[model samples]
Target: MAAIMENVTFIDSSTCAILISAFKAMQLKKTGRLVLADSPVVQSLIELTRLHTVFEILPNQKSGIIGIDGRVKFAITIIGPVN
Candidate 1:
């Protein structure tokens, strides 16, 4: 998961669903920290997974952050345009 996430900070539609499914599968085990931009794609994924608490939606564009934490074992970033 780290290798997959390490390659990109921005997420386009092509990979969004795949990554979201990966996170959804991990929801039960709490295997990672998901940093999601509050965009339509993310909102849809959240609903699909019904795993709202597992995702940390960026509160503001300026303060958004995405980083890896070994303790969590995985990390994902859902990037969006500045609002």
Candidate 2:
């Protein structure tokens, strides 16, 4: 899926929805990384984890190194189905 960190904001219901969709589409069931622009203790992040149990949350500092559209809060790299 895709996420935007921008200058502020991270993890919302919509973001969670996107992740859920991605998981269903890609069949994610193993350990994965949730790259965040800031911290993973945000409300949305907490909610996301509570709803889904597939990815591990980690802080991302290489957002600048990656070319993204709009702003990004968090990003995930799922090569294939986790299961």
Candidate 3:
């Protein structure tokens, strides 16, 4: 899979939409990881989306992250230096 907006410094609808679209496009996989590069845009977007239930947000949005699809639940991984 390809990463977009490596480091998101500012989160916006576009980014979220892109991610959602990609996630959907990616379809449901048993094992998958979506890494969100370090960027304020990305962080802001996550805060606005309120997707903690489906994703894990790391302190630093530049380090690394993992995302998963669950029928009973959701998974999200975040990485970077800023929580």
Candidate 4:
């Protein structure tokens, strides 16, 4: 599974923790690359948690999809803040 976090300017510690948990969970069941699109906050959090080695960090969603499927396809789900 791949997650592309965009326009996320701010993220609290608790939320970061939750994200880490979810990423880890996904990692366990992942068949392909577990990619995370670049976001300064998210990248910092991942580095802080030492999960950088666990996930494949990509520059954008398109790259992430390519990294996963080796081509661009419409096979993605975008989940964002409720507000």
The most accurate candidate by lDDT is 4
Which digits, one per residue and each the tens of the lDDT, describe model 4 over residues 1-83? 55555556787678557656765565565534343444577677766776555544444444434335443322222222222
Off by over 4 Å in 1: 5-12, 33-83
Backbone clash pairs in model 1 (N, Cα, C under 3 Å; residues 3+ apart or in different chains), count = 0
Clashing pairs in 4: none
If ranked by lDDT, best first, what sequence of candidates would result? 4, 3, 2, 1
lDDT of each: 0.44, 0.47, 0.49, 0.51
Reference-based TM-score of each model: 0.30, 0.41, 0.52, 0.47
Candidate 2 pairs with clashing backbones: 4-71, 4-72, 4-73, 5-71, 5-72, 5-73, 6-72
* Residue range 1-83, candidate 1, lDDT tens digits: 33233433454555646656666666655565345343455455554565444444434333433344422222234332223
Model 4 regions lying over 4 Å from their true place: 27-30, 33-35, 60-83
Evaluate model 2: give its lDDT: 0.47
The alpha-carbon deviation from the true structure for residue 4 of candidate 1, after best TM-score superposition, in angstroms, is 3.7
Stretches > 4 Å off in candidate 3: 2-11, 29-31, 60-83
Report the number of clashing residue pairs per model. 0, 7, 28, 0
Which is superior by lDDT, 1 or 4? 4
lDDT of 2 by residue, 1-83 (tens): 34444454444677667666766665545544343443344535645467524544433434443335533334434334534
